[model samples]
Target: MNFLVFVKQVPDTETKIQIAGDGKSIVEDGVNFIVSPYDEIAIEEALLQKEALGGEITVATMGPNRGEAALRTALAMGCDKAVHLEDDAFEGADSYATAKALAAVVKKLNPDLIFLGKQGVGTDNTQVGQMVAEMAGLGHIGMCVKLEIDGDKIRGEREIEGGRETIEVSLPAVVVAQKGLNEPRYPALRGIMQAKRKPIEKLTVADLGLSADEVGAAGSKTEFARLEMPPAREAGKKLEVEPEVAAKEIVAFLKNEAKAL
Candidate 1:
């Protein structure tokens, strides 16, 4: 069995986001970037599968040159290979365009199983994995919390609106990992040193047989009209009155000021 995991680089969740001058992007300067937390879970799941099934794991990502750092981190966590899908044309790509590029690689690699995060942190569109599965003409299971591989099929337990559902899909399918899938492992000192020596393969739009207009901003189906900071929240009012009075005041605020009733 061969495993391919897709990872994404995102702004650190703790980093303060600032709208760029163009109002369609963020200011990258002085901001720390990390692998999307969900993607980290996907990588760990791939490693676990490789350990039990006896195969090589290849981790891939589509982003700027900086995205190689995410691949290196995956490699340091015991993945056997890394691929960086980088091109200037990939800039400003939406989930649709991004999935097209990723699906192309999936087709070329023809891995037995593919893994991806259920959603990227910054955008949270939750569309790329299913799109890639569609474009690749493969079965997909999303939001999987438990996965068991049996004979040429996999059984997965996934979360739903208020409960869990079980699904079974054959090999050569895509699995989108949700939180609670597994705890991600940190890169060890020995593995980190090994990662420094491993080479990362790079691919481009042209290499994937994709035209410039079929990906990136030109291929994006949606556009951001404007971007701005959210309004500041008002400080809460503390009540020192009697319990009954406080309850009455809270109800009044909710009905009249909050308008949530």
Candidate 2:
């Protein structure tokens, strides 16, 4: 079995973010970047699947030159190989164009199974895996907390509104991993040292047979007009009153002030 996992590098959630001077993107300087937390779960799930089923796992990602660091982290985590999709043309790519580029690679690799985070921490678009699946003409299951493989069938238990639903699909399917899928493992010293020697295959838009117009900003369906910090949150209100009165006040606050009713 050949398994492919898509991972992304994102600014650590704990890091403070500043809007770039261009006012359309975040400042990258001083921001610590790491493999997205959810994608780490996906990588760990793929590692587990490989351990049980006996296969090679390959991790792939798209970004600038720094993206290779993300792939190296995945490689250190036990993936057999890595592919770095890098090119200036790939910058500013929206989810659709990003999926298109990744789908092209997916077609080339034709792995038996594909795993990805349900969403990237930076964008939280939650669209790339599904789009890649659709573009590659493969079945997709999102928000999967459980996965089981029996011969040719792959069964996935995914989160629904309030419960979970199980769906079975054939091989060559995409699985968007959610939280609780599995705890990600840290890279051991040996793995980290070995990862330093692993060769990552670098690809570009031209390498994927995609024209510049089909990717990056030119291909994006949406564009950011501006980026700004959100307004500061107001301090919470405390009411010292009877329980009944407090409940009524909370209701009124929700309806009139919070407008969440």
Candidate 3:
């Protein structure tokens, strides 16, 4: 019952993002970073599984050195260990490259079950989990709202467009957790203190036997040509008249300005 959970560090949802001068990335300065909210749900699900099945939890993340903060938070939340994949060669990695790196690490760990969020809040790609599963040659189920493990098989209920679907897969599978799986728990003070003493293993692309050309921006199949802020919203108009007159005016405005009629 070895559980491996993948987490990501993303800017706080409330933070205002500013594009970097290179027009390919965001400015990191003064940006508050936290574990991706959906990943927190995955972590909570992993913790629940560990509690029920008596297994160890290992949380991993791929990012710059600053990502260690997110890993420590996962540790504080109850993961037994952490792994940080950090290297300049991994910079500007898209979903495919990220999945390649993570799959390599997963191969080294060989956990019985892998957990991930449905998508990353930062990129919102919703592609990495399936890519990792494919690269690792493991069965995968995505958007799982409920998960259960029995014997050597795992059953999950996943959300669909208008309904939910139940999927059953064998062991050594990957599960992408969706919202409503479970509420994530806050790290306790004692747990936070203990996390400070936990060992965090750091690895680089070379250590994973991957080449620079196979990851980072070089490996990205898509490129961002430019970045810009969305246009500002226009001011609204107000109407002041008798109720009946206002009703008529609204209909006329809709017909002429809004064109809804």
lDDT of each: 0.93, 0.93, 0.93
Q: How many clashing residue pairs appear in each of the predictions shown? A: 0, 0, 0
**Residue 157 local lDDT, model 3:** 97
Per-residue lDDT of 129 in model 3: 94
lDDT string for model 2 (24-72, tens) is 9999998999999999999999999999999999899999998888998
Off by over 4 Å in 3: 239-261
95-130 in candidate 3: lDDT tens per residue?
Answer: 999999999988999999999999989789999999
On the 0 to 100 scale, the lDDT of residue 181 in model 2 is 88
Q: 134-188, model 1: which lDDT tens digit per residue?
A: 9999998899999999979999999999999998999999999999999999999
For all predicted structures, in order, the TM-scores are 0.94, 0.93, 0.92
Q: TM-score of the candidate numbered 2?
A: 0.93
Estimate candidate 1's alpha-carbon lDDT, on a 0 to 1 scale: 0.93
Q: Listing every candidate in turn, what is its Cα RMSD in Å to the true structure after a full C-alpha superposition?
A: 1.6, 2.2, 2.1
Q: Roughly what TM-score does model 3 have, to 2 decimal places?
A: 0.92
Give the better candidate number (1 or 2) by TM-score. 1
